[model samples]
Target: MSTLAGEFKSAYSAGSGDALAAVFTPIGTQNKPYRLQSFYDFTNAASLQKDLSFALFHGKSLKVPRAEQTAWVDIFAAYWEAVGELLKYEQDWPGASLVAIFTAWKKVANALIRGYSSSAGIPAWTLPCLYTVGKYLRTFAINADIKAAPQGASSFGFQDDVAADIEKNAHLEEAARIINRMFTLCLSDRAPMEESRKWGIYQTTNLIFKTYFRINSVGLTKNLLRAINAQSADLPPLEAFPKSHIVTFEYYVGVIHFLDENYAEVREDAFFRVIGLTQLMQAEKHLATAWSMCHRGASKNRELILTYLIPCHLVTTHTLPSDQLLAPFPRLEKLFRPLSNCIRKGDLVGFDKAMSAGEEEFVKRRIYLPLERGRDIALRNLFRKVFIVGGFEEAKEGQTSLRRTRVPVVEFAAALRIGTHATGRTRIDMDEVECLLSNLIYKGLMKGYIARERGIVVLSKNNSAFPGTGV
Candidate 1:
């Protein structure tokens, strides 16, 4: 008890926010020095209060500064009180619900925020402690909502319940409101660059971004972007923040654009070197960077980056992931490798089968629509083969030999039959083949003009037959 009190006093007196944050941080978080579990006997609230009070107020060795005494005591008291409730909730004690625990923690977070805002000296550094508190408030609210649902309810059923009753997840909604307050507090800070609470902006935004996403309120993310953009001139550069913050912010922003179907923008922001690349090509670069940045740690983050990257790579570059790339993530390989092979071989029938096999997972990850677009690329590859087989026209003397650019529509119809694995008795339709070719042209996957009257596709000889690929 004395040692914990000494450490807390030492951290508080030195104005080391990081150390103080660790003191209040829960167990299981990385590198946190003093977990609440280490000091308080959570099973007994009376003993917990006595130890917390002795640590904060009554100990002979503990000496809180007079000017800061009130705020410090209030903050620590609320924090331990909340921790006591959290322990009860975790053990599923009678009458101890997530809602009650969340309500307790909110007071702790509010007390810290109040102290930070009211005390002008060195409390700015403790802003991360505020983030830790707000993060759990959101977490507990989510768990509370899950607990409120009927036993064995499907995720879709819970979603339907939420839609039918806005109050079903009221705790989560309330958590969001408090996190927004945290966001506003961080954004509105006018302190000097070095001492500013503005440094906490992205962390707070990331928390709210998570909350909004969990509650199926993705459109709200745009308002967050707008608010940040309005204050960008006054804020620090994104690169200046910790890599963890930068990586997470970029990830959410990337997903936002991806969900809006703005693949080009996602790629444009990835790297300046590949400016004119296809939309998904750029998007893959962006996602690849995110993957590389976090590849050394956090397997979950790496998996998420690759989950989106593999589909983008297929649709834009007309390529498949090598074994080396997919080797580290077996689930991703299982989800994508078959689709990759099917697209590469122009096996439309196999592609449909692969999609069906992984439909549940793809939809769950929200990558179904983007991945479904790979069919067009498969069609493009199939037609490229047809063009290759058509070969060059024979040249007359004094005339330069040129490759044949005009392909009969019958040729595409035949390729479609083979790609689809149609039986010999199955008849192919020329009109449907024309419709397919038109779609390829419109999407720039193929560079050609369809001459409906002549029943042929006139490829553009000026550039490669396919836009991105040389062939």
Candidate 2:
């Protein structure tokens, strides 16, 4: 007849105070005696351990239907309340309560996810819930570690908990997989690039990138990259995002490639793509800091790299909150950590480590992973012209007025600044641009366009006229 009897009739329930007190203390009683509601709260919280354990181990047999979503929400909410109680008393139980809290948090996460797709079919709110749980887990882990450090205590390994959960559970993987699959399906199938859905997709993808970057498992990184590529065709034009999601993806891909030691790929794909995201970078301070590093490269080759790369770094580090950003990227902090050492010793190795670390972290999180392949295609277009003279010029309509009938090849090094589309017949005498252009022409980056009847010359398209690749 009791409410607890009706609501928590499931075998998973752990019963009331005397029963639970044996396992953990009774902390949530608001009034005199233990009522049905109290029992409901107590039982649900304890049940979280069982729920998560079951989901992690036995998810294969589970089926989450639309009608059960609400039930799951109630189940999760009860657990959430219980966990709050546990945290308040974590000082008392230490390891035991910490483990219990972790287990219960997992259950709440499971319940929320199960409820994500309701009778309405995939509640629009599921993405938010997913991100919230991810953040909560992350925060809880940090807090727990911080609490344990002073006491000389360590257990319930929070990172291991998350890693294991993700590694073991089909549902968590499916949650990530399904969102990625949706993006891929929509993009490849030419499904409408609905703005409404992209926000959620972007956040989820962003989380996946952060997690994999933390683990530094090349296998995970490779898989995430493949997923991004899978949906590349369905992505909206890069022009669709000037500041937010688009720039974020580009920044991640670039840094990931940098870490992977694919320098040429970083240069062609990330460094050159900065023009599109420049507006976004200029407004963000952290971007400016990284941009300073971009300019710190050695030699003309490195200098050329810094042009676009600086922007990518800034976009990655500054655009998102520091907490939400890819701070956990493996070996990333280690790379930057040596900056002080470099400054202290004035050593090249330390300098290189710091520079590469900062730059690579930015590139992976912001440039490479989430970019559509169209971006790759764009990068390739510019890559073809990297060795060509005047190829970096921003040539518009192929001519610089009647006086300058053809886009002239300045020295290659000079062309790096002005781009492939110079407008006037200024009779520039830069030897670097001339040599670069001539070499490119020889190498096929610049095809000679001659009007035989008019005895005039024209510059062929340097792929997309330098707009797409930033050259």
Candidate 3:
């Protein structure tokens, strides 16, 4: 006990925030010198009180400076109170509720934030301790919400009609409110650059962004962006922060625009060709950077990046993911490879089957609508094949031969029947095929003029008939 107190005092005096944070971090690591288990056995309340007292108030051994003693005492007191409640909750003692557990942890977070904000000489490095406490507060709140929900209810069914679903997620909403406080604190700091709380702004913003997404209040994310933009002149460049912070911030921003269906802008340059909105392209760049930077670890994060990237690529660029691209992620391969095949082959029936098979998973990931739009690309590919099969026109005696740019509606109708796998008894509707062709032309996917009376499509003879495709 004396040795632990001595170590804590030394770390506090030296402003070794990493060491201080590890003391409160719940999970144990092989290299962490002070695990919760090392300090007190949860089974013994007396032992916990004794150890906590020695660390916080044993004047001879702990020796906290007088100026910062109140903040120090309050921080440790809240942490020990939380630890006591956690013990009861873990043991399933009577009346020990998840809400109580979350509340206790929230107090610890509030104490840490207060200390970090009000203390005169607190190092900015201690900010991560606040983040760690805030993170667990969110976790416990989520768990509490799950525990509070009715048995057998689908928590994912969060719609305006279901008042119960909204009520059940109240804890998550509360967590978002507290996290926003942390964000405001970070953003409002006016300290010197090296010791300022502003360094923690993105980290807190990322947490609130995640919470907002979980509660299905994605529109609130825009408020966060606007807040950040308002203070852009004061904040450091995004690149100055850790890669984890920048990557998460970019990812949420990307998904926000993605959900808004704002992928209309496209840009081409010597080094790269981006066929999506400016925000999405920027997101892809950062996600790609995250993938390359953390190649050896963060496998789940890399997979998440691909989860949105694949659909973004398909919708904006009319391109399919390559086999090599999905090779490392077998689950993604199963989910997307069939769609890629169907789109490339213009097999509409097969595409529909693949979509049905993965509909639930796609919808759960929020990529279903964007991917559903790939049907148009599949239709475009089918008609492109009709032009290919039409071949070249016959040459006149004194003239050169030209590629067949005018295709009969009947021929396109035949290809559509094959793509849709129509039965022999099924009638192929030329009008419907013409309607599809007209949409492609209107969307600029194809450069063509439709002749309704002549029942033919006169595609542009210019080299770029299909705008995105290298046809």
Q: How much does each candidate deviate from the true structure in C-alpha RMSD?
A: 5.3, 15.7, 5.2
Residue-wise C-alpha lDDT for candidate 2, range 1-471, written one tens digit per residue: 132323222222433322321212223345524442344444345565454334323433334453553454454454546556465454475445543454555565555444443342333423444555554544444344445445543333312322321223323343344334433322333223442334355555555554454334434656766865666565555456434444445444544454443223334344454533443343233333333333332233232233334334423331111322224332333433344334333233334444555664434333332222122222223323433433343447965522122553332233344332234334435554354445434433345543435433355443332332333
Q: Which ten residues in a row have the lowest lDDT in candidate 2?
A: 317-326
Q: Candidates sorted by lDDT, descending order?
A: 1, 3, 2
lDDT of 3 by residue, 1-471 (tens): 343455567777678876776667655467644445444443254465445654566666545555456676567667767766776777788999889988888888887777767753455767777778878877888778878887764553422111224356888788888888889889988888888889999988988887888777888989989999999999999999998888777766767766655324322332222334444555566555655655457666667778878887776577799988889888889989999998998888888889999998787777787788788888888888888878888988998877788888899898877776543425677778888898888667899898888988898774567887766
The better candidate by lDDT, 2 or 3, is 3
Error of 3 at 463 (Å): 3.6
**Candidate 1 TM-score, true structure as reference:** 0.85
Off by over 4 Å in 3: 1-7, 10-14, 28-65, 119-121, 153-167, 262-296, 396-400, 422-425
lDDT of each: 0.74, 0.40, 0.74
TM agreement with the true structure for every prediction: 0.85, 0.38, 0.86
Better of 1 and 3 by TM-score: 3
By TM-score, rank the candidates, best first.
3, 1, 2
After TM-score superposition, the amount by which residue 434's alpha carbon in candidate 2 deviates from its true location, in angstroms, is 27
